[model samples]
Target: MSVTAAKGFTAAGIVAGIKENGNPDLALVVNTGPRRAAAGVFTSNRVKAAPVLWSEQVLKSGRLSAVILNSGGANACTGPKGFQDTHATAEKVADVLGVGAGEVAVCSTGLIGVLLPMDKLLPGVETAVGQLSEHGGEKAAIAIKTTDTVHKTSVVTKDGWTVGGMAKGAGMLAPGLATMLVVLTTDADLDSDALDKALRAATKVTFDRVDSDGCMSTNDTVLLLASGASEVTPEYAEFAEAVRAVCDDLGQQLIRDAEGASKDIKVEVINAATEDDAVEVGRSIARNNLLKCAIHGEDPNWGRVLSAIGTTSAAFEPDRLNVAINGVWVCKNGGVGEDRDKVDMRYREVHIVADLAAGSETATIWTNDLTADYVHENSAYSS
Candidate 1:
């Protein structure tokens, strides 16, 4: 289960005739709640999709009653007509669900610079509304896939409340929220302020650190909605932890299912001058294409790691820098340490630890090895 794992939520997915391939392409999630509080995070990119722009305004109210999502077309770069289409879709959903148009959030993903078929999508919204069920979470997740081989969902239940969500992304994964559409729902009785704080905190360390291909999508959006059906307000720390766990799990799933990826790389930067420095160093290492290619070839290339770190503005001494690959110290004192061959690379998960030796701060960034299949898939993506 995904969003519907939480109480007071009903969801559905159905074929919307938007994708020429006849794949499921429309999803709807509604909050039948006594209280509706919501928060959201979107891509930092200046060029945002129409849905993102519309949803940003909707979230300003810090309340939501439903979310409508679709795949097969991003509805981006299509100008005023695209935004009109998005607003019209939301109106259709509101008309069917008998909710305020301002209370509806929309999300779209897939190829950019294309217009969605409103003829098919609007009717699909009605169909999805009719099929809404408590168990439609998985189907909704499947309807949002582009090139993903599998759908992703995560759930965390506390003593009396739960936080659950679904995500879709297999390519164009990078920072600025990892090029994905994620909707998280909870039954805990929390206000918009609490939900906003926890969501920002959770996403800062989770989605903000995943860099698969160093490409961000314009449609990236992550939403958290509260229904207050449980009427159980746990401690802020506990709720925040549950939210972080779910986001972390979903972030890892995105890396595991990265397009054409073979090895999941964990780049840990330790002993940095500050947390910002640590994060900068970790992202630098994770986004280095040379390091990614080398990882795919099972090579413990510490030099590539050092080179990537040197490109960052972080505080570090080349002579004091140390690097470890899969628990084997491959570089120490900025020179070769143990034999590189001793570092085993037989597993699908590779760990790279970089010690800045400047302070006591640390950060980890998740990424995946680059592969030829990635090029082939992306080259023919629009064809």
Candidate 2:
């Protein structure tokens, strides 16, 4: 259940004075042996965090030995100074670990437009490096949380290899890889090219499919490190599959813990003319506040679902559409099928299946129900 007990890497977390509450806000994960090949994905937001910019450059070499992450101060919108802070943080870690700065990726989350507390962060990095251990994954997970109630981590073992990951995010979560931070480590002997390929594929299906608040974060990054410490190389197919399972698990946890969420909604769009169309349909519906609010209110408003899909370019004739909620047919051929009152919404999980009646392509996206709490939590978040 602990992050370190999962496998592949050693981690440590310490209070870095980044948060006013003095919670542990700095974390480090080191691939202790056999240097690992690395691959990373970052936010598509044109405005990126300083750590994201730094890590994006480091990942180009396809080699990584460690990662340093902090919460409570997202080093974004601080201009050149933010970049300097990220570089300094990585350099401090590299100096202690005896590795090049490029071998360490940096990530940060929390309030944007502010500077990081470098005075405390630099020393905190030293303490984290000293506490590294295989069982320190949970602590590292804990250290990176902003509004999360609990740390999110997942481990999957396949034959001779193990893949594990830690994630943190409770708000500002949407597609293009949620406004979250994720670090995945594996003992599989994979080259950087393969690692990159696998990570992209996995993210496309998992992280890229979740939209909780529709607001993207300034700091979002997913880094994959392979230690090859196990000395057991599996087929690339097998390794990628294992990595995907871990990502899927973490993605689900992110949605379940979404800020102010009362229910986790899974939106499935089927029969689209193409995969892109399927995803477009799914995302439009996932990001619709009206539909989300309807679901939260236990209102089987199939009309809202249709209206959301109509806003997309999924090539579906309005009259040919069909909708179902929690396995109960609510609409058929764009008209009401069963009594809306027959559906139950008391459960924590909700499913919406939309049939485009086009081609065979399909996609699924995970989102959360909208509630008054969501508005309250975000409206005054920065205050």
Candidate 3:
């Protein structure tokens, strides 16, 4: 259960020949709501997809009745015709769902700069809208996968309401926000202002901290829609916490399933002067290609960790720094502490802790180890 795990949402996934392999590539999520309030976050990338541009404008009214998503064409760098295709898509879904085109949000993923097969995609909306059901969340999640080995979904329930979401992204895993495409739904009685506040606060730490492959996508989009079907108005802090929990879970799943990764690495930076310092140091370590390769090889390379941290502008004295791999304090006071031979690196999950020895701020950035399979998959991805 994803979006449909919450109330007032119906979803469907279908194949409309958008992919040559005949796999599912189109999805529709409709909100049969008492409220149409919504909030969204898109890629900070300068180059964005046609759908991203379309959805950005549509969400200005803080209302979205449905979201139409497709995988197999990014519709980026295709200029005016690409935007026209995205517009035509929203219009089709709006007509079917009996909502204005401006009230529908659209998202797409796949190869960059390639135009979508509108002939297949436009007609596919009809099929998806027809099949929409409250039980269709899982199918909708599956239809949006690109390089992911499995579909991702998360849900959290409280007294009388629930928040649920689905995310799809394996390659281009790093993001100011990642989607490749994420849709979250909640039945709680919240307005657009509240939803926007919570969505930004939730993503700031969750999606923003995930850095697999260190590459952002052109089609990234995360949307939160409120149906107010549960009729429960949770305290703002409580509701925001619930949203954060789902985002954090989904972010971990993305790291676990990073394209062709052999290890899930968690880089935790501690005792920094500020939270921003901790995050900067942690992200630097997480995105270090050399460090990722070392992790993939199961080589407890503490030197790479220090080297990675040093490159960041975060507050840290070289001599006061400390490093640990797994549970072994391999480096202390900037020198070798425990015996390097005593560290074990056979586990699929590796944890690296860096103590900045500055103050009491900390952050964790989840990432993945680089492997030959990653190169292989990406090299042939557009084929």
Best of the candidates, lDDT: 1
lDDT tens string, model 3, 22-95? 89999899989998899999889888888999999999999999999998878888999999999999999999
The 10-residue segment of model 2 with minimum total lDDT is: 170-179
Candidate 3: stretches off by over 4 Å: 171-179
Order of quality (lDDT): 1, 3, 2
Tell me how many residue pairs clash in candidate 1: 0
TM-score of each model, in listed order? 0.98, 0.97, 0.97
Error of 2 at 113 (Å): 0.3
lDDT over C-alpha atoms for residue 309 of model 1: 96
What is candidate 1's TM-score against the reference?
Answer: 0.98
Global lDDT of each candidate: 0.92, 0.87, 0.89
Candidates in order: C-alpha RMSD to true structure = 1.6, 1.9, 1.8
For TM-score, candidate 1 versus 2, the one ahead is 1
Candidate 2, residue 92: how far the Cα is off, in Å:
0.4
**lDDT score for residue 216 of model 3:** 82
User: Model 1: how large is the Cα RMSD against the reference?
Assistant: 1.6
Tell me the spans in candidate 2 whose CA falls farther than 4 Å from its real position: 1-8, 171-178
Tens digits of per-residue lDDT, candidate 2, 110-172, equal: 888889989999999889988998889989999998888889999897877788889999534
